[model samples]
Target: MELGKIERLLDRYDEGETSIAEEKLLREYFLSEDVPEHLRSYQLMFRFSASQAEEKLENKPKVVSKRNWYSWTSIAAILIVALGIFFYNDSSRMLNDNGLGTISDEELALQKTKETLHMVAQIMNEGKSDLVYLKEFNNTKNKIIQID
Candidate 1:
């Protein structure tokens, strides 16, 4: 409120050292209708500073340059090509005109066991369906004989 205090605050403000609360106080004091005409110029300064502070920054985050874009694109392309080449080479190595390498004895035995179990399951399912059809056929045959 005192002229000396206001002058000190103004000095702090000019040095960009004023806290937000201090700045608000300054703005309110300078904007009041009772403000002395001698201090009128300072009112404009605070108003401008406040408006400038509130302004939304233009080009926030800035545009990515073409060179940076090209660099990242080329890096991604190279990685993709490397991945493709690695997978292709690995697959090619795993295969040949004769097919993949011969299985180990243990692996062969396991495969044989899997195939046997699959065939057995298939046979059991087929027998179950056949039994169901036979039962139905016998019932119909008996009814026909009875009708006769």
Candidate 2:
């Protein structure tokens, strides 16, 4: 009978031996209200599976925020390089008229070196005097704080 064929199809379907046509027949039979009481569970299962197949994906395409920081950074780098080249060319063109790149006069260089050393020594002596004041301040702080 038709019921025996349906039972055989169900067994074949469960064993993964049913074709698409067989599955469609099974679906059609289970979806009908005339399904037997004994096979109600299969009908519910098929109905739920059918409903799941009808569901549409709720995934809406999201608009991601794009950043052009690389473009801006490249523009800034190009401007910096352009400015550097311009300044380098300008400075090279404007060399001092006095062909005095290096102090060719040894005596003048020695005099200049001595003057610079004297100025540095004077500043260092001033710093040493300030250190004396700092030591006095530290002594006064220790006395006021009473940290024996």
Candidate 3:
């Protein structure tokens, strides 16, 4: 191979314009034992590339069958549907058994609401009475701070 041609290819390679065939020619030239001293520095790189290309993978690719995947997916779907139906029927049965499916009269519901509110108000008033102790404690702490 002509040194001029190799120099031209090198320039093109550096410019990212060299074709695969040109690159192969350059690699072969650099890998040869008679590589010129000026081009000897590039020999190591080409030798490394050649060695890498010749390397064989130790582990073969694993082949997976998708047939079992479809079956498993279908089984999972069936189980989901079965569980959903079971839960729905159970919930409906519980609601019906507990008489929650029936509607109460508006007047009765209003009476119950008023009773619940009265109880809540009574509880809140009791809680407010307890807060009186908290107010006394706060006053005592403030007086102690002033003394310090």
Candidate 4:
């Protein structure tokens, strides 16, 4: 190829407007031993590309299917839904069976609360009686020690 034509192709290649055929021609021109000194710097780049194209991988690449990923994701979603349903039903059943369901009568609830509070009060009063005896014993011990 004429030097002028090669220079035009190089300009087009630099501008990223060259067709594949033009690029191939440039590569061939650069790879020749007769490349002019001014264009010799570009020979290494073309040689490197040619070498890369001819190079082969030692091991073939492994290919994974998209369907397998989808299957696992689907199974996980199903398991999560199943677990949620199971816990919801179990909790609802426990609430009804254990008499923890809705209590509609406000009066009955108030009466139950009063009884519970009364029981707690009685237990506290019994403890208070024991504390009274403890206090008397401590007072008598202190009086005896003062006399000695």
Candidate 5:
């Protein structure tokens, strides 16, 4: 092909106006060893493009599928649930043989109740004393400001 035609094709190719056939022609021209010195850079580029187009992926891609993770997680979740159920059942099955059984004694129960009530009454009296101080402060504030 004429250098002028090749140059015009290149110009159209740059402007994105050339058809695929015109681009193939440009590639063929550039691939030839007789490419003009000025167009040698384009030759190198077209040669690289050709070589890359011929290249292929030799190995299949290593796809990390979520299936493995999901399977493992499900297995782990099942194992955890099984272990929890086993422990719960086993603990319940074990007898309360370690001095932890309940014994009923009316007198002892009555004494415990009385002591609990006495402590509750003491706590209530302490809280009530704090309430008396708050009431005195409110009364003094009412005397000074008369907030109705």
Candidate 6:
């Protein structure tokens, strides 16, 4: 009841020797309106602790159903997998239906002709590039092996 006793109890509390019930008692005493002037300094601290202990309607968190959460997640995963497979199969079918499918005899002949033309063009370009490099190399060698 006295501030000195309360101070001693608080000292014991600081040393971690006070029980939960003793702490509650201290909180109740401090929260009371008639708290002594000497103990007024601790009123806020005890009142805060007391208020913290009181359960409020808003304190409890909103609960979600685990079964529903799992069900939705599974459905989403299945939809993603199904969509991936559908798109992949559709693209494969599209590619086969287009000109990229296995060539017939006439298409094979046309493809060969196109390939031959491309090969000839590549060979001609490569020859021109090589000739340019060869000419530069010859000039460098001639400079290095300078004649009288």
Number of backbone collisions per candidate, in order?
0, 0, 0, 0, 0, 0
Q: Give the clashing pairs for model 6.
A: none
Clashing residue pairs in candidate 2, if any? none
lDDT of each: 0.86, 0.89, 0.87, 0.89, 0.88, 0.83
Q: What's the distance in Å from true for residue 93, model 3?
A: 2.1
Instruction: For residues 1-148, write the lDDT of model 2, one tens digit per residue.
Output: 2999999999998899999999999999999999998889999999999999999879988755345767788899999999998877566566777775578789999999999999999999988987888899999999989966
lDDT for 142 in candidate 4 is 100
What candidate 2 gets wrong by more than 4 Å, as runs, is 60-148
Those runs of model 4 whose alpha carbons end farther than 4 Å from true positions after fitting are 89-148
- Candidate 3 lDDT for residue 87: 77
**Each prediction's TM-score versus the true structure:** 0.35, 0.40, 0.52, 0.54, 0.46, 0.49
Query: Which RMSD does model 5 reach against the true structure?
Result: 13.1
Candidate 4 total steric clashes: 0
Candidate that would win on TM-score? 4
At residue 80, candidate 2 shows an lDDT of 100
Comparing 5 with 6 on lDDT, the higher-scoring candidate is: 5
Per-residue alpha-carbon lDDT of candidate 1 for residues 1-148, written as tens digits (9 for 90 to 100): 8877888998999999999999888998886666667788998887787789899977779789999999999999999999998877556666676645555689887998899899999999988987988899999999999999
- In model 5, what are the clashing residue pairs, if there are any? none
Write the number of the candidate with greater TM-score, choosing between 3 and 5.
3
For model 3, the stretches where C-alpha displacement exceeds 4 angstroms are 34-41, 82-89, 101-148
The RMSD of every model to the true structure, in order and in angstroms, is 19.2, 15.8, 12.0, 19.9, 13.1, 13.9
Candidate 5 positional error at 55, Å? 2.1
